[model samples]
Target: MNIKKENDKEDNENVEVFDEILDKSFIESYDPSIIVENQVTTETNYGDFQHLGCYIICVLIIYEFLLLLLMGNITFLIFGAAVPNVIGCIGENKNYTFTENGCIKLYEIQKNESCIPIIENQFESIQSEYNLYCKEAENVKQTSAFLQMFAMMIGATFGGQLSDNFGRVKTIKYSLFFIIICCFLSSYATTIEVFNIYRFLGSIFVGTKSSVLHVLLLEYLPKQHRVWVSTIFSFSPNYIIFSFMAYYTKNWRDLMFVISFIGLIGLILINFVKEPVRWLIQKGKLSKARQSMIFIEKWSGKLTDNMEKKIFDYIEEESFKQEESQRRKKSYTFKHLFVTWKLTSYSLFFGYSALVGCFINYALIFNLEKVSGSIFMNTAYLGLIRWFFNISVGILDYYVKWFGRKTCHTLAMVTIILTLSIVLLNIYFPLQQQYIVRFATLFAISMCSQIFIANSVAQTELFPTSIRNIAVSFQAVFARLGSIVAPFLFGFQSYSLTLPYLIMVTMSIVDLTTIWILIPETKGDKLKDHLPNKDEWIFGKKNRELKLLKKVELEKKYGSRCN
Candidate 1:
């Protein structure tokens, strides 16, 4: 069988020789989806199992550790412990003012008087420690939350640069180290200013490590094994644990310390792992790439001599291709994402979807008080529901061929809109049963979680390896941007109860439009390692017809056996 090119004699010769080499071992050692237009993608089949356990565990622990800190702080402020009533207040004028709840309103205080704050119990929380109560204190709380998310946005950008330039594993390790130190310092903060400072510092690494580690894990796993990402990587179960811990500890400082200690597990586990082979090869570290392959072979105990030889041959070929591609173009950065029209469109579409998804996700959580239920129980329910949906979405993404990434993402948005609309219905036509209202609220938020996994997998698969982390990080930056703004709009409830849900519905519509129009069906597609060229634009209709025709021609010549 001839699998040679006809346009160029030189190319035909190269293809003939390459096909000869692949005939030896490609059928058994690699996924054939990697072959396209004479460009070979190097992927190993053995290392996924070896790398998956440690990768998932390490990411899960560290990711949940950071989220636990964020969620615990929010939960403590929203649903506080028992509050002591003030019996009396001592004035700065040496006069005593008696009042219920132990104090006079700030507005009622005389020019020469000051209200002394009094407390009965030693319940430790940000509000109690910093006296973040009253109308003016709301601004401080908002600012603190804003700063934490702002730091995260900057960290996402910085982390992507570090990952693409230095390597994913190194960036992850350094970020985790800083996170542990800052978390400890934040716990011991003596003042609000000091506490916010340490938290801001820690959040930077939180954003950094989260993006880098996720990209690393995605790179390590094969396309087929990515189902685990949505399930194990959900880490939502940690939410239930966090709720229980917060209830039992009842001290914000203790909670922070606990989360800090948990981060140590991820730090330890990551030390045992190495850089992914894909990342190593992309960066032109052929020697290191080969070493990584050997390491995986040892771990999996499945790389026979023949399989090893085939793997090395593929790696050697990919290395030569990488060198040639690099000579044609320089190293990739975030700017490259927009260099081509196709790249720009994909980047913007996914980035916008991420922003909208995250906004709706946090908005619903912040608005959880509107639902009629215990906050702790509601929080646990959110986690469990999200976990179950994560697994469901993963199975559909991997097994259900027709339910592609675009369809799944579109379904999630539709579900959110429909559920939130039900919540809206309760506003105009109040639901007699409070449980129905509560269910809609929880259901809306839980379904929105699916968007995160769907958008992430689609972005990773569609983007090339050269700028893969940057693409993911670009989306993270947008997601963090949404999170930063969510709290401010969370106050829309004060103006009108229906306003928040209305906003979410509107955003969901916008997200659904993007998915239907811009996003592609990427379920069974190969992961490209080079930047896209003309006629390969994700939204190029003409390109699709050309590809289809080419595929038909090849099928007629090679028969189905080529597949």
Candidate 2:
């Protein structure tokens, strides 16, 4: 009995020694308090109740889809659709009867300055001609177009910040309600100034919706599907709603009103979306978080204390694994974002944003006038093509993992450059038999541009969760700025298309170079693990060590009482 007791005491001492070493190493490497808090509150592996809420939220998102459709297409049509038609209307002879074919003829005449206005002595006739001319002037329409683009950018930037500070759900709901108010006001605006104000206000909500919806959808989804869901949320609704918009309204004001009504629907539906569990935890609403988790459990039909315990255990295990890997790493800081290696990633992201914004926005508009038979025909054709492209891309998204993001991006960039080159060459050297070629080139440009969808995945994976929203929004802000500028620069003069295309090509080359130099392979990587090598220690390494130490401490503190 005396010998056995001595052996047992020896074993206990050895275990204590082993634990002490682990504890010290863990504390030196990571912060234990942080790991334990994260493990208890991170809210991963949700039960079915959460998913049910997600489904309800998705239905609300459909209303968002409707609003997004209205906002994007309304701007597209105002600038691309109305400006050209108004220009054609202004140059038409006063006595010339309006006919479908005549509209095309009048447009061509206006393009060449062949149509001259007839002078009349009568005051009424002069007044009538002046009114029509004012209505159709390209300069006036162009200003409106510029305002719409500017509004989109300004709104998005401001909206993104607001959404971050307020709850995502609140930002979405309020912005949507504001959108409805703007739409109604827009419908009643008699002067150009009032119309612009309404449009600008509506644009703010439009911009807010973009980031807010993305964050909400991504947070609501399981981590595995978050990227995919974000992409779908970004692309699919624009295609569907815009296609419907094209089919519905002829008057610009009527279109604006229709869009506002859609925004109201989205606002009403906002009540259905539950605040994400992660957001609740972040806000330190533990009871609400528990209710959300239990709701998910019941809905999934997997409710049990063991299941909750297992989730807790899994989190601890992951925490320890991270700590073990990070034991030897150094810490990272915000300054690391500007260092030599990290700057490459920023440059690559900026280039990608610039290229997509300029090429897609301008190329599509230029192609409509250059390729299709008439302005109306071009609008119809481009809308249809865009619809097809979006649908095809949605399908392609499922298989994008197979091609890999870098390869897919490179392929798309190459395709866009080639197609754009052909269009630019046609512009330089007019061809008698090249109409078909021009049309084919435009279609290719639209198809190739679908690759920008990859931006959501790439940008999201490039930064840690702490800076992900800010980083993504920063890149997006630049992209929106690019979108705002491309139109005024490219579509301003009849001959300005060459300058824009040349600039786009140059941007694409830069994008490709940046992609090659930076942009590490990120396929199948987790969001938390996306930090660059330097950041791996601070955000990555220390996190792991802290977690392991906490786990050991928990066992030490709770083992005797529980056993």
Candidate 3:
């Protein structure tokens, strides 16, 4: 028994020596930045649960739904269905002798002393008020939409710079305030010119608020949960809400007033949300970051004292690094996006994808007016389809590990390409079944919407914290360009029904090629918080490989505990 006990003791001592040597080896090659990043990753994983995550998500949903009311389903529903000539008649030769189908002869016309031409409408609209049925005024509708998109493009770029330089929270609040003001003014405008001007201005604020909100939400959430939260939040319920509101509200002015009121509600709700700790740390606001961490700890019941200590240790270390670099700290702008070849490649591919996606999606929407159906029903169908696909994609992203970001993206592109091809077939074969045509178009749009959210989460994952907001906003600029061009593309249908779809297919092919060639798979990867170093910037491989290896070593040493 004594001999056996001695042998067991010797075995235990040898095991300890091995562990000590392994730890020493790890310590010698330790990178403080990597350790800090891992600590943050762990903390965020824990932070994904409890009251804090729920609260933030609720606030974001409200913000998105409210903004969508102003610019999404509601705006499209009102404008797309507002034509006076759809159900009524514009009289011929300054006489009210025209029937719903055609102009009647003088013998069939009702007797009248003064035969002045009158325009009749099913509902009050800009088309009725401004006499937009004439060829001279037809372009005005397209011009209004184009101006709004152009303004949004400008706003997105401006918001990115403002958010990075100032702060996300500040930018959101200010943008909301301005949006409310613009909506209110739009509701009371006496002239079409004034109404359009207010709408253009309001769209700018909407774009700003949207871009900053995305960055803020992503920064607050964990990597795994971000896909779902970002995707699901984008699933706007406003389409259903707008359908009911438009059914009851006949006047466009009343609709505008209601949208403005919703904007006010959003402004009030934004105060309950907090700034992201990651953003605060990146900006070197350690005190604020510490306070935010304490707030998180208070709400998160699962967090332990040890976890809290490790988190603060990371903050302390980061503070030292920030102080060391404070004197040489430079502010990032849109121009920095082109400074490196890697960045330039990412920017070009992503921007083109955004542009193409917006063009195809909105072009389909604008073409809805030509589809033979109730406009309200078409809008409702699209809204429901988008909601269904958004949830489905979100669930897939959250649950399916193998069906990753790039896979989801590629699948969406394929779906779009195939559906657009079907649209082309319908154009050539001339489908007699209108419902079949509607379904194909809606399906294509649903897939486009899926791509919209997927690209958002994927791009956010790609860019670092320093320029993340601006990079996203730059994509928004391209998306707005697509939106701006959609009206003009739809105009080509007047010349050739197949022209627009052909262009869209060509663009989708280009986008798919860019995706495989330029974009990297970013799933199961750590979120980079800083720009690449000199070596990594030039070669684009060294730092990432080194950091990844260190992560593996740490994970192995910790075993399941790290997971």
Candidate 4:
């Protein structure tokens, strides 16, 4: 009886030892929580590197070659480069001549005599008809601009939602199709009324494309390279394309045709481009995610079992890691975006939009005559300078380690204000010898206002991932609304060109102040680590609950052993 009892005790002790060893191995190999935390940092090798490289090369060749071909066509080139100039010229020239105390003497070919010939009896009637037509055309253009602005906002918002619901690729594909159709329709628009309709439709698709492109680019890159890739990728092509447009086409309709051709190529390219693997994983499409991983492995060499495990574990654990507040049983309607905290962000973002719209549309257009020799030269110089500044910033973004995102944004805002203030001073004081200084300052303002890129990154990071797209789209909508209102604001005879800048500066000051007070610093931190601490005041009672839960879990796992 004693020997039998001793054997049973020994067996029980052996079983406990084996269980501990198994638990340790399990923890080392497959702890989903740890995997989730570290997945962003994990360096995984993808297999079949040579094959993958070839595939990437092929895709790039196809896309780049087609893009170049479309861009190189004379009609495409002319439309892209020339139409914006015409638009800019018309928009600016009209604003300049019609403004309070503008030099309208130059526009007056003959003071009392009409440019068109008519018999004395019909002269007054002919003049009246011409004035009516001009007024009607102006109205059409204004209405078109407003519709385009609104459509862009709505499209961007809708695109973001669609991309979140469908895949990024699908959203982009649909947007491209819309763009293509609208562009073709725009080319055929006979009257200003039809033209405006096509433009509104086109703007809608363009807005969607813009949103999708940003989201797609961010998701396609590795986490560490996301900001750099996004900054460069987003702006460089736009500048190049716009620059080309500014240099070539005279007719707006021709430009529309060029853009449509580009859209067609973009649509074709979409067939070859892979859906973002990160997005695939996020949406719980594991098979597709793994397929993406397999494709990456072909280029990067084979990933280890541990690397594969980490990726899978991170996706699974992300749901649990969602903020407790976000996971609460609250209504999921879009109106939730208007909650106090969100509203604050939205207001600031709206101000940002207003600043952009006012500066780009009204102020810049109004001030162009004071800067450049002619409309064509002005556009060329403006496009070149803008491109140079954006490219310089893109290159600098990768190297600048000291400047925080907020600091850069703040500096840009301050620069804009200072530049505009100088312009305002120039107008009031009439700097006879400082015209060059005024022009240079305006140029700098145009170049530097792009600090919004950094601001956008900061905004995207602040919101949780679930609401990120919607938040961005809503902010864009407000910005578009600001854009729509800007033309009309400056349209008033009472308002000077400087008035819009002054308003922008005031709003910018508010934006800067709010950001300094309310916005948290988000530079150089991994995205996952940047979440607001549950213990912060903003989180309220939820913080304590989360902390308590964590404590309980820690105690259950390690209490007696640590003691």
**lDDT, model 4, position 137:** 30
For candidate 4, lDDT tens digit of each residue in 1-563?
A: 99999999976765565456456563343233431222365433221111334444444444443333232221121222111111111232232123222223323533543333111111111112223323343354346556766777778768767776777778878877877887789678666567667767777876676555655554444444545544444433443554456446445555566767777877887888787665564455656766676666555655668757765665445444334334342322344344346545654664464456334433344334335354445545654665565556555655776655667666666766676677667767876777565455546445443555665666555654445556566666666666566545545535575675577667667766766766666665433322233333234444443344444445656787887
How many collisions per candidate? 2, 10, 0, 20
lDDT by residue for model 3 (1-563), tens? 99999999976765565466456584465554543333533433223322335455565666574556445422543443355543332344443445453213322332533333355554566666666653333466677778777888888878888988788888988988898898889878888888889888888887787678777877777777777766666634566667666656666777777777777787887777677777788888888887777777665544678867866787777888789779759998887777568888998888998998888887777656455566667767877887887777778877888877778778888888898898799877987885887788878877777777778777887888889998999998998889888868966867897888899889988888888888888876667777765323434444444444555566677797867
Is 1 or 4 the stronger prediction by lDDT? 1
Ranking by lDDT: 3, 1, 2, 4
The residue pairs found clashing in candidate 3 are none
- What would you estimate as the lDDT of candidate 2? 0.55
Error (Å) of candidate 4 at residue 76 is: 13
Per-residue lDDT tens digits for candidate 2, residues 1-563, read 99999999977865675577566673454444443442554544332223434454555466455447444533444322333322233343443434334445665666866564332211121123234332353344455556666676676666545654556788778877777888788767777667777777777666666655665665565544544444445433464455456445545566666666766667667776666665554444445666666666665667788867765564454455446546544433334444345644663575465546544655455334334354444444554664565555545555566644576567667766776777778777866777655565556545443555556566555655434555545555666666665545545345675776687677777776667667776655555433433322344544444444555677876897897
Model 3 vs. true fold: TM = 0.80
Q: Mind sharing the TM-score for model 1?
A: 0.77
Pick the lDDT winner.
Answer: 3
- Which stretches of model 2 miss by more than 4 angstroms? 1-81, 84-136, 223-243, 297-344, 351-355, 366-371, 374-401, 429-449, 491-497, 529-563
Which of 2 and 3 is ahead in TM-score?
3
lDDT of all predictions: 0.70, 0.55, 0.71, 0.52
Off by over 4 Å in 1: 1-124, 134-137, 534-563
